[model samples]
Target chain A: DAGITQSPRHKVTETGTPVTLRCHQTENHRYMYWYRQDPGHGLRLIHYSYGVKDTDKGEVSDGYSVSRSKTEDFLLTLESATSSQTSVYFCATSITSYNEQFFGPGTRLTVL
Target chain B: AQTVTQSQPEMSVQEAETVTLSCTYDTSESDYYLFWYKQPPSRQMILVIRQEAYKQQNATENRFSVNFQKAAKSFSLKISDSQLGDAAMYFCAYVNFGNEKLTFGTGTRLTIIP
Candidate 1:
């Protein structure tokens, strides 16, 4: 798991609700990323952070928001969870952009 | 944008045999990196191997080796002496130099038969 931990390994929530997933790392890597994995589609980046308070959108950023207030913590929030947002989420960290990334075990979210 | 393609949706191999999974990528940049990640039934993404575009030598780790064709824009992973534990979903990924985003392929599911 590379010193990374994601809270709420499994969660079931109703649609139109709010859900937030937390990613914490001990490696103190400068780059952190949040990705979602679904059937037929590989892991798709939802958001990433370069440094504390520095965040950027990824390919599938809709209905998702991210916040990074600390180097070791990156949070992904779904303001209004929808059925389409139900998927397994993974968090990854890297010392540098060009270096290999270390992934967390992953968090599975289900929206009904 | 860089894109990775894994042509094989599923593959199977006999125990102690070998299998090769195909992957092709499209990238305009000359400086980049390619990686193979394994996701077993546990759904944990594990780094199988990596290859730098600048390196001519293929990267290898124990039973895992890659056939990298820089000119052909192809990178394939070969697993020798296949074991049941090796059965998993393999994903090919690409990352450009100085970029933080990783583009991944759909993945190839591998099954090892005893």
Candidate 2:
């Protein structure tokens, strides 16, 4: 919610295929994050961007890459998605490090 | 490294009853933030409550309140007058000062019985 939108809410893709998930925010939050949710793992951060063209890896950055071309859009790309990458992905935005981060509706990606 | 732990994997509470979900964290930093997020069947992550490490007073929102024991390094969520809508998986998360990245715990699945 909170003016955050994630595209392709549900997608079923084949193994080794490239996939990109988009997150757009109108709130102009200064920070954006990409995370994945698995059954046993609550939510693991894949990557984050503090400003346009400024990105950094997170705890689970392997097999995933991110880019922030504008203040409103953050993209997550899986070069070659594997079955292990199948999970629900969430995008969150925060105005600052101390502010409450707002989350967008999650995107469920299934790799076959 | 900071880690959050939710010991209870599953819990059930009858309608109109109270339920408490426990969460604890391990962190060396004194200044940080704690949060509880709820994910229902719809798969939307909702912020239920939050507590700041420096604040001594517990944070309360409607029927949702938190028991924050900073000395004990514990933060637990209490929900009163539970309803069917309260059935969801709750996650406890932590973030250190100056860092927006969050570390989350394995969730606790809550079931509401009529």
Candidate 3:
């Protein structure tokens, strides 16, 4: 749990629509990460935030964007949702970049 | 780039027996960290154990332990006296000492027979 929460445990939306997922943490960690879990792929990193207003792309950041306005909150957005983007999204945070991460319950998103 | 691989997609063990899950990774860096994470049906990811690349001794926590073969580039998890609650999808992850990203394996679903 690690004092982390993800909003909209489940979501469904049509293709071409925009979707945003929120991740909130109370630990005040300096590092936050967004990942998507698929059946065979396990989990893949979409984006990550080190500090407020500082972010970077991951292996699969083509259609995803992220923002961290505060130490406790990080948001992931999909400009235009697609079927390929449908998967369980997880938010993780850690005290340092190299430490073990704590994950949220996850948000299941579906794009039809 | 670092890549983690979990060869056993599924495994089963008797309630009171022991079982091992295999994991291997390809990393060019000499310093890194290896981790085992358990995701139950509830979808909660739990940290089972961790092994630092520089540590020669295997890490142990309760009934769970890791056999870290640095030279072989293999990390395996051993669960002793498995319980029914141990049924879950276990993932092997690796992160370099100074890297910010973690690479995960496909995962192995472990089942404990009652």
Return the TM-score for each candidate structure.
0.98, 0.97, 0.99
Residue B43 lDDT (model 1): 88
Model 3 Cα lDDT, one tens digit per residue, B16-107: 99999999999999999999999999999999998889999999999999999999999999999999999999999999988999999999
**Candidate 1 similarity to native, TM-score:** 0.98
Q: C-alpha displacement of B39 in model 1, angstroms?
A: 0.8
Q: What ranking emerges by TM-score with the best candidate at the front? A: 3, 1, 2
Q: List the residue pairs that clash in candidate 1.
A: none
Flag clash pairs in model 3.
none
lDDT of 3 at A53: 98
**Considering lDDT, which of the candidate structures 2 and 3 is the better prediction for this target?**
3
Tell me which of candidates 2 and 3 scores higher on DockQ.
Answer: 3
Residue A17 displacement (Å), model 3: 0.6
Q: What is the C-alpha lDDT of each candidate?
A: 0.95, 0.93, 0.96
Winner on TM-score between 2 and 3 is 3
